[model samples]
Target: MPQSIHFISIGGSAMHNLALALHQQGYTVTGSDETIYEPSRTRLEKQNLLPAQTGWFPEKIHTGLDAVIAGMHARKDNPELIKALELGLPIYSYPEFIYQLSRQKQRVVIAGSHGKTTIVAMILHVLKHYNREFDFWVGDPIEEFDTTVRLSSTAPLIIIEGDEYASSPIDSRPKFLAFQPHIALISGIAWDHINLYPTWDEYVDQFESLAEAMPKAGILIFDESDDMLDVIGQKERDDITKIPYLAHPSEIVKGETFLITKQGKRVSTKLFGQHNMKNIAGAITVCDRIGITEDMFYEAIPTFTGVSKRLEKIAESTDRTVFRDFAHSPAKVEATTEAVKQQYPDKKLLAVVELQSIDNTNKSFLDKYKETTDAADQVAIFIHPGSADSGEQITTSDIQKAFQKPSLHVFTDSAALQNYLLQERDASHIFLFMSSETFGGLDLSNLAPKLI
Candidate 1:
């Protein structure tokens, strides 16, 4: 009989992808969730992995199953979890399961507070260009990639975007810890996940722990541009190979970004911004260690567009273009705004950012935003119309005090945000929206056409 696996609360972003990957591997996959959101819902249904019904059924757990995989969406008292526990069936969190499957392969993990996803996507993109067979588990959905998680028995390497966030409610370990890569890359280090990690030291400790976990022969790659990563890259790992990368030289001409190869060749690419130059350089270093040369990197990197929600173009016309990025952290917000402004220096740049995650939304962390979004000509912050201002959610006054910009605009309601965006639709301005959450759940595609 085929190996059977069951997932508890399987409709999450990562959970759904893992389910699809397992199904593709010929495992008998079954899953249940109380609430299944878009994209995940549609993707799961197409794979025939969607549960027969929406809610979890304890009866779905059986003694004959091979193992049970649980996601962060599943609570400790989830009926399926309780059933699995009662039956004494083996249970593993998503990260644990990923590790178990790729234990035999040369695991290459991209770990950082930011840019890890892009680095992972770029590595996968370049590896594909060279026809290198490797598997991956990225947090966000990268453009052109069907799923975030890919697994294969024949592949000799597994590239993972190993974030420092908790693996699951039951597992307090960081998801990256479970992977324990033989080769790892730290893109950049910053304080984030304020809710989970209360202090900057705690945040640093996670990445430091990741560094210390490497084997004697393990290779560690990090960006030397970041101050914190500079410390990480030079740590006393005498036996481990530590590679440091800076931004790959690039120039924007006639609104197109080009990578200046080592041989002085100007290679045009879809990617822009100084930060992205660093991302490309980091990816190239990773590829080089794995046998891909600098020439191979330039060839493959040109075709790389970017990952989803990271400077992803939503709507464009002859006059105007709108970009959406998943930039909730303070460091990312600053870099993303600077990048967009650098791309369209002569045009009027409007940047609207939202506070979604605990770190970005928490009032105590407001001081970190001081002058973070100053790069944009016009800066704005969107607070959900119906959200209460108490607790972790911040108010308009809170935002105004945080950034301390004289001309910054704060839209407390979706209507005002939408109306403002629509009013600027015809203006000669470049719009960049940075938020982990949608702008008051507004459909940006509908608004993009009316704007420049």
Candidate 2:
């Protein structure tokens, strides 16, 4: 008989992907979740893998199950979890199972507190351009890829967006720790997830531990431009190969960014920003390690549209443009704001950020966002007053005081914020909506047409 696997809280982004992967691998997969969201719900339904209903049933757990995979959303008190533990079935976190699957393959883990999704997307773009078959698991949906997760036994390469977040409820270690990578890239480090890591040094230590997890023959690729990474990369790891990459040589002309390659080929890209240029360089280094040459790297990169929500253009008019980004952290907010400003310096820039993610909503994390919005011609910071979870709360005054920028505006009500934005936005201003979560139920897409 084929192996049987069950997933707890399988409706999550990564959990659903893992369930699909296991099913594709010929396992008799079953899963349960308390709630199901779109995209995951639709994708899983298409695969005939959606649960019969929303909630979990303890009866679904049986002794015949070969293994169980638990998601972070699943609590220890979950009936299915209790059943699985009672039966003594082998259980794995999503990352743990991925590590097991890619153990023999050349695993390239793209890790950092920021830019992980973009860096992973960049590497995948180049590999896909060359038509080289490889399995990958990224966070966001890519335009060229069918799904965010791909797994195959025959594929020789696997690239994963190595997140520093917890793997599962039972696992306190960061998810990246599960993948003992043959090659790894640390883009940059910044304090995030205050609820988890608690301190700046504790967060920094995760990357250091990730570097130490690499095999002796493995190569460590990191960003030399980041001062913290530069220091961490130089830490005495004599057995592994340390390859540090700086930002790719580039210049902005007429508000357009072009990359100058070592071979003198000037490659212009639709993607903008110094941070993106740095991401491209990091991707190039990883691609080189996987046998792709510099010429091919430059040739393939021009076709990259970047991952969805990483500065995704929602609508465009003769006089204005609207962009939506998944930038929620301090560094990401700064980088994305600066990118938009630099891209359209002649146009007035209006940036609106939602404090929905854990890092963005935290009081301690707010200080790091001090001057991130300084470049914006006008800025609005919106936080849903009743949206605080896990006892984390931030008032409008707290946010205003934290940023200390004269142009900053704070709003607790999403509707009021939307109204304010509609009034403030004009034909000459570029509107950028940034958040890792939904805008407190505001439909920005519907609002975009009215703005245009």
Candidate 3:
């Protein structure tokens, strides 16, 4: 009989993907959640993995179950969690379970405050280019891969995009901590997850601990250009081989980005920007450790169009293009805005960002947004209070003062924001939609009414 695995709060992005992967692996998977969103819901329903109902059911947690995986969305006192505790089944956070699943395989964990998805996507693209067998879990959608997460018994390696956020409601440690990567890369270190890390030092300490936890003989890679990552890279770690990489040399010819090889050969790529160049370098470093040579990397990286929402081209024409990026943090926002502006120098760029996280909208972290969007000719900020239960309310004046951009626009209503974008759409303007959420339900992709 197939081993049974029950999931609590399986409707989550990662949770649902993990459940689907496990189900595909022939496990008897069952799950329950209070709510489930689109794509996840549709995918689950397609697999018959969705529970008969949305709410929790203690009866779902049975003694015959082989394991119970839970997401942070579920409280410790959840009925199913309490039932699982009563039954004494093997319960685990998805990250821990992933580590358990990959124990026999060499693990490559890509971690950072930003660039995690881009770096992972690059690595996956390169590996797949050479037909290397490996499993992976990444945040953003990749056109080459059917799902964001994959696992198989035959693969000898697994690469994961490791976020610094708490693993699960029951596990407060960062998700990357559980991977214990055989090879690890810290793309960059910037303050994030302020609610959990609270202070800059405390947040940095997590990456420090990640570097420290590497097993003797493990490989550590980092971006040398980032001051914080450079500091982390310099830490005394004689036990591991530490490699630092700078941005790969590149030039834009006819508005197309290309990677310059050591021999002065130009390797064309669909990706752009200095940050992506740095991300590509980090990915090459990792692939090198895994036995993929530089030549192999150059050939494969070009086909990697880009991640779904990271600088994704939602709409384009001869004169203008609209892009969407999952960039909400200060560093990401700055890097993304700069990349687009640099790519199309002559176009008028309108960069719009949405603040959906409670911590991100707080006054404590507000200063980070200062000048982050300066690269764009016009900047807009959207605040969706519905998403952030942040009882800490700030006015449009507070946002305007925080950004310090004289021409910056702020919107509290979704309709106003959509109308603003629609009105601003024109041939001379290049639109950049940046947010972690959907701009409180604004479909950036659907807005692609051919800005020609």
Give lDDT tens digits, candidate 2, residues 1-452. 23798999989988998888878889898999999998889989988999999898989999889889999999989899889999988888989988888877989999987888988888888887778999999987778887789988889999999889888888878889898889999999977677788888899989989988888898999999899889989787869899999988887898778999776768988789888988888988998999999888888888888878988989888888899999888888899999999889899999999887676677767778899988898889888776554685678778888887888888877898889888986633799999987778889879988777
Off by over 4 Å in 1: 386-393, 425-428
Q: What are the per-residue Cα lDDT tens digits for candidate 1 across 1-452?
A: 23899999889989999999999989999999998999989898998888889998989999989999999888898988999999999899899999999889999999888888888888899888878888889888877687888898889999988888888768888899999899889888889787788888998989888888888899999989889878977988859999999999999897899998878999978888887898888888888888899888887887888888889888887767899998878888989999988888888888889876556767778879898888887887887654432544567888899898887888877778889877766554788989888877878877777675
Model 2 residue 402 distance off true place after TM-score fit, in angstroms = 1.1
Q: For each candidate, what is the lDDT?
A: 0.86, 0.87, 0.88
- Clashing pairs in model 2? none
lDDT of 3 by residue, 45-112 (tens): 99999888889889888888999998989997899999988888888899999998999999999999
In terms of lDDT, the poorest run of 10 residues in model 1 is 385-394
Instruction: TM-score each candidate.
Output: 0.95, 0.96, 0.96
lDDT of 3 at 116: 89
Q: Of the candidates numbered 1 and 3, which has the greater TM-score value?
A: 3
Residue 26, model 1, lDDT: 94
lDDT of 3 at 363: 77
